[model samples]
Target: MSNPVLEIKNLHVWYRTYGGYSRVLDGVNLHVYKGEKVGLVGEAGCGKTTTMRSVLRILPEGQAHIPEGQILYHGNDILKMKPRELQQVRTRGISMIFQEPAAALNPVFTVGTQMFDVIKYSGLSKEESRKDNIKRLAIQAIKEVYIPDPERILNCYPNQLSGGMKQRICIAMAIVTARELLIADEPGTSLDVTIQDQVHRLLRGLVEKKEMSLIMITHSLGVARELTDRIYVMYAGNIVEVARTSDLFANPLHPYTLGLLSSVPKLTGGGVAEGIYGRIPDYLRPPGGCRFHPRCPRAVQRCREEKPLLRDLGDGHQVACFQV
Candidate 1:
């Protein structure tokens, strides 16, 4: 196989709080092949957002620290890249579509102004960067997500548009740069079911059309299963399972993965799926050994005393569970 478009190895990130440092991402291992869609799925506060932020190098100033692991892009270490190199990566290589479009856009400026700034910031020439190109690109992006009348929409302020419309605009801006990798942090979170499906399809279309790899973070298992070729199940910042979508769903080894799959609402007469009992452990002082042991139905004594390393079980499927 060709080299992966992006790779992350044992990424450990922490946030310094008034009380203590909270381990937000602990040894997260993930990768995205060129033109592949990889899903990062987990409950809220499970470090899904933090992992995306780490890749973008947009962690709040002086708040989060990378204590361990390496993030590689085209075989280069992202953690070691200089400021200029990282900027190039952020602009020419990778772009992000944040979850909240309202928060992502500038309330003070028109959409056109903001988009022009983004395009110029990515190193476009002022002379070559015509207003028509900016407007056309923006409209095309908005139209790709099935938004109505992209021309009029581009002229409006972010606050003037609906939440779903704003999200499409965010996606448009991210992909309009023609970056090789797109990090979508809950791109469909706020939209209704019909609109969500439209946006989801639009995202997949964008990745396929541009041959760009996508790292989509979401809590929706259905979304992950439908869009991503590979799925990573994260719990309290730890990646417990990594497998192809079909293989993981057909034969999930880790108890956490099983619990997550079981919770997905099914269409058959099985009624509403049951949720995993217990809450996510506080990151300030998470559980020792296996973090999921407390909630794992099949957890044994080994799970409480020793943390399991991710062991490949052939065919590229991996799991971190002593019982498995």
Candidate 2:
């Protein structure tokens, strides 16, 4: 087996908000081998973004802290890294595409200038040595994302481009570093169906051509199915089920996973889609035992009294439900 490029072991993060600390990530364990594509799917505010942000150690320092666990990147503990070491890992080892593209880019700066700054951190030979070389790299990255007018976009500010165009630009900036791992937190959530398809296809091509690992975080199962080799279903800060994409779509073992699928509007099913009710429990005092018991249809007494451990069910499938 190939060694894992990234490993998150028993991660627990707490955010010290005015309302009290939110147990954002409760023992989130995940692994991604080199050149692999992985998906993390969950409802809104279920710790998907939190999980990805924790890996980079970019969480608000005063507001959030990892109480326990280790984030290992190529055998080095990221949490223990010095400031200089962390900077190297962020720019040279991993890249992240934030959920909102416009907000990520500087509104005042031209796209080309912003991109050149990112290229500078890439440690590429031309990043600071030659302006023309950096420009060439920027143009190439933009072209890789299929933008027809690279020059026009390079001169424009963030407000000048349409949502889709801005999203593509954001993607270009993230991949410009040619890092080992790319974490895309809902890359094109605001784009129309047509734009989304095109962007997603471009993303797959880039990852394959570069042989970089990817972590796709989204609420859409369709996107996950289209882009990832394996999928992990997250709920209320815990991963409920994990399996190969084909296996997950064919045989969903967790009740929560089934509920998510049922909620999707199937063209063949011919009925209104079902929706999961009940807000995610308050993190100040989360539900005891299985955090999902109150809403889990198949929940038993054990589920209410004791947390279910994630167990391997052979063939790379894993589930945390006692009923499974």
Candidate 3:
């Protein structure tokens, strides 16, 4: 295969809190090629958002920091870049969609004002860029996500729109830049089931149509299975499994992967879904070896003593467990 558009190697991000230091992302390694769609699935607080934040270099200032590892975009190390270079990357290279729309948007600014500002900063001329261009892109983007009355919605404030509408608008803003890599941090989180499905479809279409790479952070395996070419299973800031979508669903090697699959709710089943037994270990004082060992049903004595490197199992599939 050709080289990936973006590659993350051994990413480690942590925060300094009142109690002590908390490591949220530890040794996260993955790659995203042009036109590829990759889904990252994990339970809440499993470092899914942290991983995405690391890529954007927007980790909470002072509170969280990328202590180790390199983020490479098209073979260039993003971490090593200067400030101006990084600013260019934010505008022209990589873009992000936050999980919550209301939180992302400026309540004080009109939607048109913010959207036009982004467009103007992107190198478009003022004459070429007006309320019309803003409305055009905003409407087109919102409509692509299946939101109705795009023109009317564009004029409305974030508070005026429902949660689902706001989410769609946020998605439109992210894709409007037409950047090479789009990092979506749970774009469908607050929407209803029907709206969630529409958001998923819109995301898939955006990737296919633009040939843009996507790193979708979500908790839904169903969405992952439907939209991603590959899937990475994470737990407690560690990536436990990386594999092609079909191979992952068919033969999940890591205990965490199996546990996640078992937890997926069934539509017409007679029994309740089985949940993972233990909670994620505290990042401030994580386990000595594999982070998942405490909760892994298949964990053995060795699992408690040694952390495993990601081992290749052929066909780009890898697992990080001695037992696997």
Give the best candidate by TM-score: 2
Model 1 weakest lDDT span, ten residues long: 120-129
Candidate 3: regions farther than 4 A off: 125-135
**Range of the 10 consecutive residues with the lowest summed lDDT in candidate 3:** 120-129
Segments of candidate 2 deviating more than 4 angstroms: 126-128
The number of residue pairs in model 3 that clash at the backbone is 0
* lDDT score, candidate 1: 0.87
lDDT-best of 2 and 3: 2
User: Model 1 over residues 105-180: C-alpha lDDT tens digits?
Assistant: 9998888778777776776667757877766766676777777877777678999988877888888788776789
- Write down the TM-score for model 3: 0.94
lDDT of 2 by residue, 1-324 (tens): 977999999989999988888887788889999999999999998999999998998888898978999999998999999989999998899999887888988999999999989987777664354888788889999999988888888999999998888888988998986799999999879788898898899999999999999999999999999999999999988988999999999999998899999999987878976577677888888999999898888888999999887899999999999998
Error of 2 at 292 (Å): 0.5
lDDT of 3 at 38: 94
TM-score of each: 0.95, 0.97, 0.94
Tens digit of lDDT per residue, candidate 3, span 168-243?
A: 7777787775789998888888788898888788888987888899999999888899889999999899898999
What are the lDDT figures for the candidates, one per model? Answer: 0.87, 0.90, 0.85
How much is 271 displaced in model 3, in angstroms?
Answer: 0.8
Report the C-alpha displacement of residue 144, candidate 1, in angstroms.
3.1
